[model samples]
Structures are given as C-alpha cells and as structure tokens.
Target: MDAKELIRALNARDEAAGPDLLARTKATGPLEIRGELLYAPLVRNWYELTDSLELIPAKAPEWRPLQCGIDERAQAATGYLLALAEADVFSGVVRLSRGEEILFEEVYGWADQDRRRPNLPGTPFNVGSMNKMMTSACVGRLMEQGDVRLDDKVIRHLPGFRPDITARITVRQLLTHTSGMGDFFGPKFFAGGRHRLETIDDHLDLIRDDELLFEPGARFEYSNSGFVVLGAIIEARSGCSYADYVREHVFEPAGMRSSDFPAFHELDGQAIGYTNFTAHGAVTGPRRPHEDTLPRRGSAPGGGYCSAEDLARFGAALMRDTLIGPDVKAALLGLRSDSGSGRPGGVPYAHGFQVESEHGVLSYGHGGGGPGISAFMDVFPDQGLTLVALSNYDDGARQIRRELRRIFWPAA
Candidate 1:
C-alpha cells in the first residue's frame, strides 16, 4: 500500500515492459536534485514500472491494489513538492502525456488560502508570457490558410510598423524575438517598479520614443513589444480581437476547454501567482492581480490561464496533427535563433514553440512567467511525450520541469 511496496512491484513490471523512451539508468546524469543525482537503480524507469502496475490491476480484478495507483517515485516527488508548496514556494499541477493520451495528471497545493481550497487537476493557473505560444499558434494557422507567411514584413499588416526604424522587421523576426525593439519598458508604465503595462498601444507607446536596439534580424533581443505588435496584427488580419481569434481557433481546436485569456475579475477557480523573497524560504509575496499588474486591459503578448491537463491536451493535439497540417507543423517546430545571450543559444524559436534538442531528441514548448507565476510545457516528439508544469508561485514550475524531466526521461 505504501510507496516502498509499490516500487518493488513496479521494478518487476519495468524489467518486463522492455525498452522505453525514458532511460532506465543515468537519466539523472543531466539533472541534479538538491546537489545529488536523483535517479538511482532503486527508482529508475518509474513511469513504466508504475504504469505496468496499473495495467495488471485492471487485468486481474481478484487482486486488489492496495495503493491508489500511485508509485513510490511519484510519492517522493509529491512529498518534496508539497513541502515547498506549504512553505509558499508554489502551487500548480504536473501532467505527463504520450501523444493523444495522458499518462499522469496530478495537481498539488492550494488554489487559495482564503477559501481553503486545494488545486485539483482542472484548476487554472495563468501562464504569463507562455501564452505567446498560443499567439504563435494562431499566427501559424493563419499561415496554413495562406492568410500570412513568416516572411511577411510587419508593414504588410501595420503600415506604421516601419514608420520609424522598425520598417524592415519581418513576422519571423518578431516571432523569434529578433526584432530590434528595445527590451526596456517605459518609465511611464512603471507602477512602483513592478513592470506592468496595459493595452497593446500602451506598450507600443512606451517603446515608441526609444531607438531600435539593433538592426532588424541582425541579432536577438527579447522584446515583449514585438509580440504585442503581433497580437495587434493578428487582430487586424483575422478581423476579430486577437483573444477571440485564438480562443476560437487554437484553444477550441486543441480541446483546451479550460484555457482562456480571461479578465482577472472573470476567473473563478484560478490561483493567484506568488513569489518567494527568502533564502531560508520564509517571506513571500503574491503577484498582484493582472489588472493591478498591468496598465492595459487584455493584450495578446501575455495573459492566459490554463490547467496542466488542458495544456497537455493542447500539446498532444499539436503533435498529433489535430491543430495544423503537416507542413505547418514542420514550420512550427523548425529551429530558429532565440538571441537570449545570458543562457545557451542554438535553441530555436519556431512559430509558437521552442525547439530544443537534448540527447538526440527534440523537445518543444514554452515557459510562462508573470508577476508571481511560472509555467512550462514541453512536447517530446521522439517519445510522443508531453510534460506540463504550472506554478502559482514564482520559480516553482522551473524546478518541477527540471526534476520531472529526469524522472520521466532518464539519460542512458
């Protein structure tokens, strides 16, 4: 019934499950958990081992599975994460999917303290800039239908796009963050230095006085203004508001019913984002509501909420050809430069996703961060796997992604 007993049974099942995409040994090589390699012989291949146990119970009803179909590794991970959640590190969900099928979907931590409600599988958490991926998807669909192309110049949609030094910027440059737009947000937009700006025009107006950081497409500079502009272009081109276009085409097609670019006041079961401000992990601050965080209402650059399950379904559908056609999907995953210099380069920013190659496998997804929350969802095409993690508190989803990557896909 306990984790140890479940692990032993799972070990037996794993040996028989045969070769899986998840490495059985040294999968922990690339990842370190609290200064130690997390995967050992004792807990390698946890997913299969645990999944096999589930199958056996269904096949033989006479024997009752004492545990609730959860494995030791999951229990250990949950314990560690819940400890962090209680300490206000974060609250969200972690979901694993293989193609169109979800293998594991679990929620952790409280959605709110005032209501004393814990986050369940369907609880929604804001994805922040991670919503850029969805914006990109809408753009890709437009391309698929010949409404646009990556090479199209921004001026095609917005004549004012090039009124200054931005005239040569292309759709691809904006999507890849290669536009020469300044990374700085205007001082007029700052509210006590929290970096919240409202309205697409408000964002553009903030940056309007600044000169281009570099020539268009010459190098990469992450500019939120670029996607804000893209959202505007989506609206102008689609003849609908950017949010409505994405909700109708991208979210609906992907079966992500729980996902939306909702107003802050509209959200009912959503968790407010939070950030920790301690080394010993004591003091914490919740992210002010988006309305309080931004100067504008709802702009396409960011502001979307979704559950882990919904995100996994979205990723699975994208990989399974339910969203776009084959040619469009290829364009979506192709590697392009993301000129983020502080981190390692060579990661490609595709249509609405990041194409990262690790251990001879391609993992594509985006991470979202807002005032207080962080979220990440990666789809591993080689293994037909998708891993999604959402955190109500800042920095929580990053650790979850790093840890679960090892647990589900250990290095050989």
Candidate 2:
C-alpha cells in the first residue's frame, strides 16, 4: 500500500484499540509497530475474532550503496543539503568533512533571537545525549589504563550505590543501556529546583529510591540514571570531578577546545534554545524560551555544548584513536542493542554511540534532543565522512542529516 493508505490503516487500528492498547499489551509483550505488522496481544484477540482478513508481513526494501567517487558525491550532496536546510528553516551550524578536509560548513538563523545574535560556525549548541559518547570515551581511557573494567559492578566504584537495585549492574550494561536503571528526568526532576542538579551526585537523588525498570541485562532500556552512575564512577575512580576528567582526557585529546559542560549561567556564544510550537505540520505560535526547561548544568547522560567544528573534530579523533584504544573503539562502534526503535528514528544503540546501517554501510554516531535543542553527529568511517549538525531549536537538525544521507548514499 502507499504511505497514506498505510498511515490511515495504522490510525484506524489505533483508534479501534482505544487508549488501553498499551496497557492491554503489557500482559503479552511489548508492541511491535513496524510497517504492515502490528503485533499487540489485544489486537491479536480482535483479529482472531475476525476471519475477514489476514496479516502478512511485508519485506523491507533491500538497501545498497550507490557507487560514486567520494569527493564528487560530497559536492553534489552539499547543494541538496543546503536546499533542505533553507526549506526546513534549519537554525544551527552544520559541518561536513572527509578525513581532515572540510567539504562544506555553514550557519543559519539566530543564536539568541531576541538579541539578534546570529549563529556562527563557532557557536556552541547543547548536544543533548551526544555527551554519552564522550562519557563512554572517558571510561574507555580508564579501561585502557587498567583503572576500570567493563565487568566491574557499580558497587565496586560507587560508594553509595544501592546494593539492592544496582548490585548486579555492570559497567558494560550501563554503557550499552542494558542496565535496568530508570531516568533522572521525570516529575521529581522537573518539580525539584534545576539549580540543585548541578553535579552528578545531585542528579543521583532523583533516582535514589527508584526500582529497576527490569532485571539488569534482561532487556535494553535507555537510562540516563545509568550514565549518571557511570559519571559518579568516573569521579570516584579518577579522584576528580566528572567534568574535569572528561575535559582533560576526552576534550583535550580530541582537540575540542571550545566544547564544555558549562552551567546555564556560563553560556556565552551558545544559542538560546527555542521551543518549537507546531500544529498540522506548520509552525503555530512564537517559540518559547528553553532556559527553564533544562537543568542548571549538563549531566553525564547529555547536555554538553560544542561547535560543529569541535563535533567533527571529535569524530576525527575517534577515527585516529586519540581518545580510545583500538579494542575499546571497536567495542564503542559495535552494535550492543537495538533499543532506540520507538523514537529518535530507530537507530541501534552501541556502547555509547548510535549505529545506523543503510545499504550495508554502517555509520556510528549519536543524535540528541531536548527542550529547545537538537543535535546530531554521524561518522561514516569507511567513507571517511563525518557530518555534524547542532541546532538551538527542537527538531531542526535531523532533516538536514537525512537529506545528506540520501544524496551521498543515493542507493540507500
């Protein structure tokens, strides 16, 4: 069926199932809502009662990469990307690079809309969950130094770690999002003063009494609390703050001079996040300020700020082994879980990176979103292509990356 027909069928099914579909499916298994396949226990019951139709799974299109020269493909892709950015009202900095050569770089819209401060190539934007990659890199360095082990339990490093809930969670599980830990951002996080969550330890309080979402390693569930625990482990083992450890080990070695996890009050050239208000595929109201929507400072799970150039530098550093050893780098890029299917466009999860595979070509990176921020960094290692986009407005970065992928990997 066509896209419109498929969407209509899905919506009709959803409406028939009512709001209790999720709850009803809990007894059987998690709902899998891929194209032409809707497997929910409650829906199955309804389907068994009706003999009029049968559900047949549709085969996914085979993906293959287009054969093309790297430089020629990149140049052609740049024009399409620029057009997509203009059409989408993309407000951010984007940089495309091949090895050490920058193929294209541009900035759009305002950093501070009220102040009329236009976003520059060097302007920093908050990369929400991309900080997890940096955190994992820091852990990898420690592992290389024989300071930590992936199999080590949380209680070994974190003195105050709850034995009941986190006793079985390993460093590897935390890195891979296989840990059963829940997130720190919830009702408690929002209701509590943002100023109180300035440090890793402070963020811990939000999840201190929470129960495991599931048995450790039983399934993959993205947990910000897991990363927070990882940050605390880094601090405890290194005898330094998480920020200081990353700055010295990851940022310095990667040549990310302008990137940092600074407090909200310390923002300088960073963009003021604007919340997009949309209705019926069109912008509706004036964008709202994103200041009060975030924590006072960035955390291990995410919220570090960096320029597009610095993000590209990070990808280059990883490729050159400036931050991690060969073994750790391999593990970081390796597929650990297929967890991010429900949101963020279905990218698979790696140790700390997001793995996107199209046409048998794998790209390793991460994308992040928050109140008024959207950021993405993709590293196509085999192709020597690294694309970084950072935006101050929510939902601004993905389309540009999507267009770039389509242009460069036409067959995909």
Winning candidate number (TM-score): 2
lDDT of 1 by residue, 15-131 (tens): 543322122221111111222112222222122223343321111112221233335546655665665555545578887777556566667777776677888888988887778
CA-lDDT, candidates in order:
0.64, 0.74
Q: TM-scores across all candidates?
A: 0.74, 0.79
Q: Clash totals for all models, in order? A: 7, 0
lDDT of 2 at 397: 80
Q: Which predicted model would earn the best lDDT? A: 2
lDDT of 2 by residue, 1-412 (tens): 5423533554576665332333233322334554435543221221121222333323333434447765666666555545545544467887888766877776788888889999998898999999999998998888888888888888888756787766788888898888888887777876765658889888887678888888888877888889999999899889999999989998898888899988778888888888753322224347777777788899789988988888898999988888987787776666434222212235677778887777767788888887688888988877777888898877678534655565566322
Q: Any runs in candidate 1 off by more than 4 Å, and if so which?
A: 1-76, 184-186, 192-202, 276-291, 295-298, 335-347, 410-412
TM-score of 1: 0.74
